[model samples]
Target: MTETLDPEDAKIITLARSVRARNGSTEGAAVRDETGRTYAASGVDLPSLQLTAVQVAVAMAVTSGAKALEATALVTEADGPAEQDLSVMEDLHNGTLLLAGPDGSLKGRHV
Candidate 1:
């Protein structure tokens, strides 16, 4: 059965998908802060710097002055989130993580 998502979560899924498509990255991630501000980013691949979508998204939130995160969403084909992704979320706040397929279908969730 398909999982139902809150409207805010659905927005993040859409943002992640757009970032992934725009960058042609393997994965995309979006995070919402306690104040309801959202940040979105795609995986970063560089000769000197390599970061997952979730990592980048979290960093963006932190750099933008987000004290805590309310939720996170990733749009990708991966079966689950990576260890680093979970670490980032833990650093911010213990919140829900929604995983979605490339087609925007809810795949899994972690809290």
Candidate 2:
């Protein structure tokens, strides 16, 4: 976590970590929309379909009528999020994006 991380952002990171642990997934993510609504999801992996945690979280926000995002948090064991994950986050609002390890330590921050 950042030295001055916002409480809301910290909450989303916690939410992401919770879902990751709950689902037993390698990755998890949470997004806060413009309306202050937050969505959390774990990465999906199936024979027919696959999605990164960030992708799933962003999709959830979009499906829930979120016009844009306010913030995003991802918890994963990977060094950082995938390119497509960053792309999807960019496709939405230019909000604060955080990448953290499963232990909740900040790894990277993307706009």
Candidate 3:
């Protein structure tokens, strides 16, 4: 059965795509940071999100970083993102965003 993507999952993909563009790694490694700084040149955000995803997948599968890239690629291709699959993606996206922030973490509640 074809599973419909959850709104949240769709949101994650959208966010990821935006992040990819901001990083400049979507095409060939022109990735940038939130401040528009090129990460490839600075090495602060080494290993693009694509690379990080791979690393996480590998680490989760084998609990090792050796095949992180391979594992992440496999998982991404096979699963993609859907409602049922959104939880993990949300966590991943949120984590990246939080870390990317100026404070490297979310601020206190506004309320």
Candidate 4:
């Protein structure tokens, strides 16, 4: 079974091991560790805006997971700088894997 990390614990993990994107599949795959971040882009050819929307939507889906349905997921990547979709569906599908430190320093880049 895949060991899914707790939303908070995922933040503590250091770096990304690898990522695999599936063509035409809603679920993408990613693994992280102390090495570095890795990602596999999605197959859906979506525009930057649409891709952003999908990423936001997928993050919402991940955070909701079978518990809270009405609450919105943390859209940190979108909250900062320019919101370019950038084939981030896989990352969002993986959910929030890292967080900002106590002083607001980002521990890891989401995508």
List, residue by residue over 28-84, the lDDT tens digit for candidate 1. 999999999999999889999999999999999999999899999999988999999
Task: Give candidate 2's error at residue 104 in angstroms.
Answer: 0.9
Q: Candidate 2 local accuracy as lDDT?
A: 0.90
lDDT digits (tens) for residues 20-41 of candidate 2: 9999999899999999999999
Q: What is the TM-score of each candidate against the true structure?
A: 0.97, 0.94, 0.27, 0.23
lDDT of 3 by residue, 58-98 (tens): 22433322221100111122212223223433433322211
Q: List the residue pairs that clash in candidate 4.
A: 15-33, 16-36, 17-32
Residue 16, model 1, lDDT? 93
- By lDDT, the best candidate is 1
User: Candidates' lDDT values, in order?
Assistant: 0.92, 0.90, 0.26, 0.31
> Worst 10-residue stretch by lDDT in candidate 1?
1-10
Model 2, 60: alpha-carbon shift in Å? 0.9
Error of 3 at 53 (Å): 5.1
Q: Encode model 4's per-residue lDDT on 1-111: one tens digit a residue.
A: 134545534432221111111243332222222222332222234565334323444343444442212111122222331233333433433333332322223434443
